[model samples]
Target: MAADPTHRAIEAVFRIERARLIATLARMTRDVDRAEELAQEALLSALTEWPKSGVPDRPGAWLTAAAKRRLIDGARHQSMLERKHAEIARERDAETDMSAEAIEAARDDPLGDELLGLIFAACHPVVSPEARAALTLRLVGGLTVEEIARAFLSSEAAIAARITRAKKAIAKAGVAFEVPRGAELRARLGSVLEVVYLIFNEGYAATAGPSLVRPPLCAEAQRLARILAGLMPEQPEVVGLLALVEIQASRLAARADVDGRFVPLTEQNRARWDQLLIRRGLNALDRAEALGGTDGAYVLQAALAACHARARSAESTDWARISALYDRLAEVVPSPVVELNRAVAHSMAFGPEAGLRLVDDIANAALLRNYAPLPAARGDFLFRAGRTGEARAEFEAAAALAANERERDFLLARAAACAP
Candidate 1:
């Protein structure tokens, strides 16, 4: 029998072309959100039409041309005032640029950085940081709302609503759909980095999946970081973020066991780390520091990761230096998550009670209430302090809160170890 195109294959097509499709459509339609809608409409057409007609050889080009045809048809059929008609007609002419070669250009980014522009467009400061993260992951990362919801430990409806609001917010603010330059570029780069790292962190430590890491998402974030670094080699912070993710990615093998259970950094086999990635990460960090990014959040964090990558054993790891880096990190990006990490570093450096004090101080904060790491850190400190019963309780709470099955199982195992 001849091979046939499956839905899964078609979806892979969408994932690969997602960023370019939205970028091309947004450029043509002069609207980011509408571009997403039209892209989906084209996908729908494919879903219905391709199974019967067979998959087109150039799926990306086909989707682009299909979406442009829809715009042309809508413009032709809709009634409008003379000026409005002329405007739509002009738009049609512009869309004709989305022919085979144009679609190929959009896909290839032949002469410009369309995807990067789309990244800035989705992450424009007009929307809230939360919205920017959600929208960028959607449009640029090619993630569905459900996947984002699971990563965030939030509801799909909430993510959907935030995406809707973000589009409207971008429209209302009249944020330009192009990459900024000069000082504006620096200011916008922070938001862009945050979105990219959010995607990376989700991949590094997935919240609600059977496995501990999602390689595809992690790879996607790294790819974006590399592209950014290529496009702007002089930017210290961009290089810093790239360094941080690269070093962290090197340890993926040691993050889990043969059965895919969670493995603490202290227990992971150091020999399993990827040397190439470590070299790249260290080189990137050296570049960042050479460019005077010592105080940057990502550079500081990369420094912290370097402490471990250089160590031959867990006991040889510099907990005191890591604690200091966390201390500086807390000042740079103050939050319960940062505080929790700092407390763990403190416990490793100054003993458990010192860290316990800090953890207890933020124990009741609303944001930390359901956050698994807060209790997990507390449990680790309590266990080290010989307060087994209290540690067991915290462990149980963390297990209950954990979203990843592997992480939850690991927590439960720790709780059992503390049984009196």
Candidate 2:
């Protein structure tokens, strides 16, 4: 069935401006749930009116204003203080004729502290790390429960519950909606970085989408990381994160062809990579290292990415160095995902057999039961070893498990190539 054009337009606007809307609302309401509710109500308004009114030229601002008015109306119904109501009313009235240019200009302003404050609040240590990731994407990344669940390979119900508890936990702990300081700042920063990286990764390889990558989301996360680096110039992790995102984003241009076909790393036209972004990433990596973050998780990952960025082509890649970096990265942040990456690295550096041993170990783990990458990696190793039949089966399994349509198609093509 065809999706409603108006619905798609509304969803697109929400995706692009969600962070701004939530940040602005959170700043005004200081209550996570209320801010989300206000935004949801505005979204409802868009759904009902946009089809008939013809989508607004400044839809984001239109939605923002609608949400703000709703906030003010709620305050009025509750008989809130006149000073508060008057202040909000004056602010809303000033933008009676909102223009798209005005909306873009206002949102373009340097990562104002309000968005950063909302991020800090989302990363409060009171909630679990899983909850932190979910809440950060929900409140800051503006991802829906279903989107978040697909990204995490969890059920939508679980993700929704986690978001609910996270908001309540933040309120219960009385966590302030401002960036922290000194020890508190250092403690919470890691979680925030983790969440931003997760958002970026999802954009880099969308979990469930027609395209393998979502450039807007990637640009959004990159913008946030760039903003964060500016906010905390001396923080090694922040600099490292900026480096990692910039480096990965450099390849975005080369990931697909003019015909929208997926291009493997070995087949990509290296000349298409963004040199400016690569240089910016390398500079940030240098700064991270200078700040004594050689052992940091993000720094390690950025260094690994640098190895690829430094190579002019796939044949010139320093797989040995990348393998070593992955080994250290595994220790810094032990997870099934890291292990899988290391196995791939080992295969490239050593031999397919050496990598396959590690791959099989990860394949049997219950955690990766539905993970597409596991079978995909195993398929590559089998193909390298000349086991055509086995490789075809693995590739077919990977294609089935893959959530992104592009990725699934790519895998299926590989499976077809293995035929007799």
Candidate 3:
């Protein structure tokens, strides 16, 4: 069945401005769920109106105003609920004479700022990290429960439950809708960065899809990162994440072959890399460093990417420096993924044997049991060390474990290359 054009357009617009729409509604209504409801209502209205009236000159602003009206109507409808009645009465009285111009003006300036504040609020530390990620993706990334589930490789039911629980947790904990100040701001910023990075990473390398890249997610995350950087110029990690994404994204053109086959970093054509994006990435990284603080996870990751970017050729890559940076990153962040990457770096810097040993140590790590890359990395090292049979087996295992079709095909090809 074909998707309705109006529905698809509404989806596209919502994807682009979901964060701002929800942020504005949250500020006005002071309830996250209600704000989302209003935003959804506005989308439905657009689906009805846009096909007939055509898309508005400023679709975002139009949606914002429509959502605002829905909220107002909802508030008025609920005015009979005693305590709610007084709140609505007060808010209505406050905006009794609100003109179209006044409303438009209000939606323009502080509203956008408040929307960003709402993003920070939604990602507050009090929320569990998983919940934070799920909620941010739902509200800000504008992803459906099924889409979010697919991204995480979890069941749709599980994803829905997580989002439901997250919203309930926020309400139960009485989390504010406003942005934090001072130290609280710093802590919340970390959570926000994590959400943004997660979104970008998913886009850059979808865990399970026919397509190797999800460009929309990448563009959305980059947009959010840029907005955050602009809003908080002095925040080093914000700049760091932007830099990291930009640098990594610079290689997008080279990351795949002409037929959309996956191309590993070692095999990518350097000439196809976007120099403009690389330069922007470097400048952002410089800003992050200039802010003068201990490097965050994103900053460290960016530094590692910079090592690759500075190399004119794959052979000139400073594997030792990358290994050292990964070492520092592991000490700070300490994830199995970092350990896996560090092993790869060690192989490049030292020898395949050294990397193989490190991979052996983590072979049984619970976190990496289903992670295809572990076996894939081990296969690469084994192949390099002339252990053809072992490399073939590892690559086959990786192919079985991989979720994305493109990655599976890549691993299978590698496995076939090792066939006697």
Q: Count clashing residue pairs per candidate.
A: 0, 0, 0
lDDT, candidate 2, equals 0.84
lDDT of 1 by residue, 152-260 (tens): 7679999999999999988787777677888999899899998788878888998776889987668878988887787667788999999999999999889999999
Q: Order the candidates by lDDT, highest first — what do you get?
A: 1, 2, 3
Off by over 4 Å in 2: 1-29, 32-115, 125-169
lDDT of 3 by residue, 183-259 (tens): 88877788899888877888899877787887767777887788888887788899999999999988987877887
TM-score of each: 0.77, 0.70, 0.82
Error of 1 at 326 (Å): 1.6
CA error at residue 41 for candidate 1, angstroms: 9.3
Candidate 1 accuracy as lDDT = 0.85
lDDT agreement with native, every candidate: 0.85, 0.84, 0.83
- What TM-score does candidate 2 reach? 0.70
- Candidate 1 segments exceeding 4 Å error: 1-18, 33-113, 128-131, 143-162, 360-366
- Residues 270-339 of candidate 2: C-alpha lDDT, one tens digit per residue: 8999999999999999999999998899999999989989999899999999999999999999888899
